[model samples]
Target: MAISLGLFSSLLSPRETSTLTFTKPSPSSSALRMVRTVTSSTVSHSGPSKIRGIMKPRKVSPEMAALVGAHEISRTQVLKLIWAYIKDNNLQDPEDKRTINCDEKLKKVFQGKDRVGMLEVARLISPHFLKSES
Candidate 1:
């Protein structure tokens, strides 16, 4: 004899197989829950409630000072200033616009490199800056 399975079968007997039911979470509820969790985690991990000290400007080296003409500046500003100088002096290579032909001042910054790519300009100029350690 064959037995037919029905939805009510499980509810009728203790030995009956259990059926799983899943309900999707509402979008708004899910979003609110996520926001709450993230906010709590951020609050817990946040080190200080308020900033403790004023930011001090980084010191500039003599070589970098001559290049940047400033006592202290951000790395980004230094790059922009160097590019401005290069443009003003017409240091870009005439043959290939992508190449930079260093002048006397730029040569010092570039470690005597006669030619460099535009991409390398930032890296070469960084050495001229005086870091606290060196």
Candidate 2:
């Protein structure tokens, strides 16, 4: 039987090389023998990645920004910040973990609702993300 593995580490800046080993099991014992080694590097991107779609940061409304502390943020990031706030303040209901109890800060963002389901959070924040012409 043969086992194939594809990195070795002699780190150099952003580039690294690792020994790619190909092994065959020895008949006499349970251990395998390394037959070959080849070094490879991690690919470096030519430029910074583009953030698009829901991940693209956009201007938010005053109420939204107050809670998130950022004038511009992606939908993904907004959700993360909101959840972090919830956890930090222990906003989730004891009876139901999926439900969030609204404090004054959350109330502004959640349209003055006292309670919000986890699924409702994503939809609720949609209006807060202002449309950008670009």
Candidate 3:
């Protein structure tokens, strides 16, 4: 099952020897389709689209700005600052840690609700963040 092209090895350079090791490609339909898909995706794609979401900074309400200490900030940062504020002020209900006792500062941001559930923070804060039309 072997054919000898006698001493042809002596004729090839190191580079040509490596190149000769691989069989010539005759890609099947699926292989070609995969190559096409990969090639299409590797092409460049860039724009402002990458920066248009909750991660993007947006203007905040006056109450929110005062609490977050910034006129404009991202939703993620706002959440972090709000949680920090709650922790610093010891605002969590002792009996049920899931409940938040809104202080005067938090009351303004939370629509004057004296009590807010932990999970409801995000929903209540949604109104404080102005609609961003990006």
Worst 10 residues of 3 by lDDT: 32-41
CA displacement after TM-score superposition, residue 85 of candidate 1 (Å): 0.8
| Cα displacement (Å) at residue 70, model 1 | 1.2
TM-score of each: 0.53, 0.69, 0.63
lDDT of 1 at 47: 64
Ranking by TM-score: 2, 3, 1
Clashes by residue pair, model 3: none
Query: How big is the positional error of residue 125 in model 2, measured in Å on the Cα after superposition?
Result: 0.6
Give the clashing residue pairs of candidate 2, or none: 7-18, 8-17, 8-18, 8-19
What clash count does candidate 2 reach? 4
Between 1 and 3, whose TM-score is larger? 3
lDDT of 2 by residue, 91-115 (tens): 9999999999999999999999999
Candidate 2 local accuracy as lDDT?
0.85
Question: Model 3 Cα displacement at 124 (Å)?
Answer: 0.6
**At residue 110, what lDDT does model 1 achieve?**
82
Q: How many residue pairs clash in each candidate?
A: 0, 4, 0
Candidate with best TM-score: 2
> How much is the lDDT of residue 70 in candidate 2?
96
